[model samples]
Target: MIEISLTPIRRYWLASLVLLLLPVAGYAEDSVWKPVPLGDAASWPAWRGPLGDGVSQAKNLPTHWSSSENLAWKTSLNGWGDSTPAVVGDHIFLTLQNEANELRLLRLDANTGQIERNILVDTAETPREAPQRSSQKFHNLHNMASPSPVVSGDYVVVHFGNGLLATYTLEGEEVWRHNLQSEYGEYSIWWGHANSPVIFKGMVISVCMQDSLADLRQEPIESYVVAHDLKTGKVRWFTPRMPDGSAEELDAYTTPLLVQKDGQTQIVIMGGNALDAYDPYTGKQLWHLPNLVGGRTVTGPVLGDGNIFTTRGMRKPLLAVKLADFRGEVPAEAIEWTVEKTTPDTPSPVFANGMLFTVTDDGIANCYDAKTGQQHWRERLGGNFKASPVVADGKIYFLNLDGKCTVVAVKPKYEEIAVNEINDTTIASPAIANGKLFIRGKNALYCIGK
Candidate 1:
């Protein structure tokens, strides 16, 4: 080794450079993935807001707003997607697919309604042979970008129906990506994969429930719940999830519901003729309630007041199961009550003010008491709906396919607050953040506020 003496000024500059480089090196070594701070009321960080429920803490949300009235700003999007925007601070992350089948992530300025960046995540690279004897066609209502982007700390994770799950910094820098089908197995779901990823405790969790093709082949495809490290894309755990069901009943297009009970965090999944919960860390099956099978699942589960509310599938009975001391197979008696009429098939139900609200795909809005499952009111909202309802400040907003939002108050009696309409077609569920409502439409992202 050779050493050279330097002047005092030169030594000082060299020391400054070393000091600046130290923190960068340390950060690279640590690679710590922070958890998103859900305490901030102004953030819609993931699929169903901070609590994995369709409830928003925002106040003064606009009760009446149209295309021109009470509009904050509207920014045109390049392509259409049913995935809702995930908002944190002043940044909004969304996913969409162009006509060329390019899956992309868009970072929008939440305050100004301007797209700050459009980063290509992946292309729809469906395998040449496709899966043998499996249906890969999604309904015309949604495409591959149906799964929404989720904000987890400084990184936003976007999932596409094509099995591409990617993470990027809020500034649109790509961090890591994985083709889940390549890692596990080909998707044999009847429609398409639209389950959004949820980030918890430094792990991004995803669920896959689909057709096993048991009748078509001697070997069956596996459905699974998987978790990956947020810092790296390395998979942390994968648990095979095969509920006892048949045919299309094995398929599900719903996202997992993250819930906490008795200080224990659980990832609740509803599909395949059953309802179950798993440990997010180890992907261990916790408790399951099976045999309530109906058709393929679309709506997800929601938790409110110590009860888990979910339907089997395809507008079956809406069951409210009380949170009890559950382990292994949850007994059938755990379900407290069921509402058999007007349950939603696509849009998930929202719980607010000791009641549960749901909008059927055919436009019937139904409200039931959270504890008793007694129907308080059932009224026709006059439009087809695919987006789930969001509740804020004691009011529920139900947006139909045609961009009509009927805001209703949370009361035992049916109380319609106001009906707001926009010209663009909307299929995505509404997102609330920073005291404003963000609606993703076929042509634009509209910000409505006063």
Candidate 2:
């Protein structure tokens, strides 16, 4: 090897160059496959919130807000989606179909109700295929743009019922896009698919729990859980999710919940007549409890007290299955409690404090003991609730399809705090972030808070 001796000035210049190169090398290493932070604790980074559970940790949140009082701002949007808004930092991300009938993602100024960026997410490369209008019978309340968007740090992921799943940066640059149906097969479900995308650690997770492939003439089709690299959108791993149900019962628009209990973390999905758990990092089927037998599950499960509260499809039973004790060989003894009456057929159950609160598709609201499943109270608030109830400041806020929000006390006893109203129609759930409520309606997006 030949060595060159340098002068003092030359040596100093070389040292500076080397120092700059070190950080570049380190950044390249850290940039690839790194865990994306979920962002501000007060931010609604996902469909439900930062915890992936439909509960927020915000305290002193507004208990009462009306159209004229405590009204922040109301901004008009192009089209509507049943999907909830995802808020990160100053931007609120929502998935919508523009007037041109193109699926899109909208970013709005969170402080003021103003459109910041409108990114067309569904392009020819990621085409949004509407099921034949003759058979594309979605529930009267939903459409193709129903799945909510989830955000984590610099990345925000949006999904549409038409199978377009795209990820973008907070600055509105496309990171990667994939059509779930294109890669798998055409989705043939009774109603359109509306399962939202979720994020865990270094990956963005998606679940397509639909009808059996044989039934759709796509013999190999199966429900699947997929995890992708947060930065590059590379498929980290794909796992086949086999839920046992028949025909119409096979379709599940339910989102998976990430539960960490008893020093063990697992992704819990409720669908196809069963509640199962999978290893989130590797997508391994860890342990599963079968025989739930509830079909077309819309209610996502919630966790509390070493047990998870789940609604078995629709109009069946609200069950609390003990998870901490059972591992393998799950049998009939796993389910600890069941409320078999007035369970919701559409809206999901929200677990907050020590109560499992649920509202039916019509108007009935029931509060049950989270552990025992004993009915605390059954009350009718009188509007049609499609949005899941949210809890904050010792009150539960339930928004109905008529744009009315009924605030209830968190006790076992039924107490109505306030019945606030908005004029627009909505099927989208309300999102809580930074001490404010973001509710997307058919005609507008309302930012309501004190």
* lDDT per residue (tens digit) for residues 356-433 in model 1: 899999999988888787778888999899999999999999999999999999999999999999998999999999
Model 2 pairs whose backbones collide: none
Model 1 steric clash pairs: none
The reply for model 2, stretches above 4 Å from the true place, is 1-39, 123-137, 213-220
- Give the Cα error of residue 201 in candidate 2, in Å: 1.1
The local distance difference test score of model 2 is 0.77
lDDT by residue (302-368, candidate 2, tens digit) is 7765577777886777887765423443555556767767889888888777888999999899888
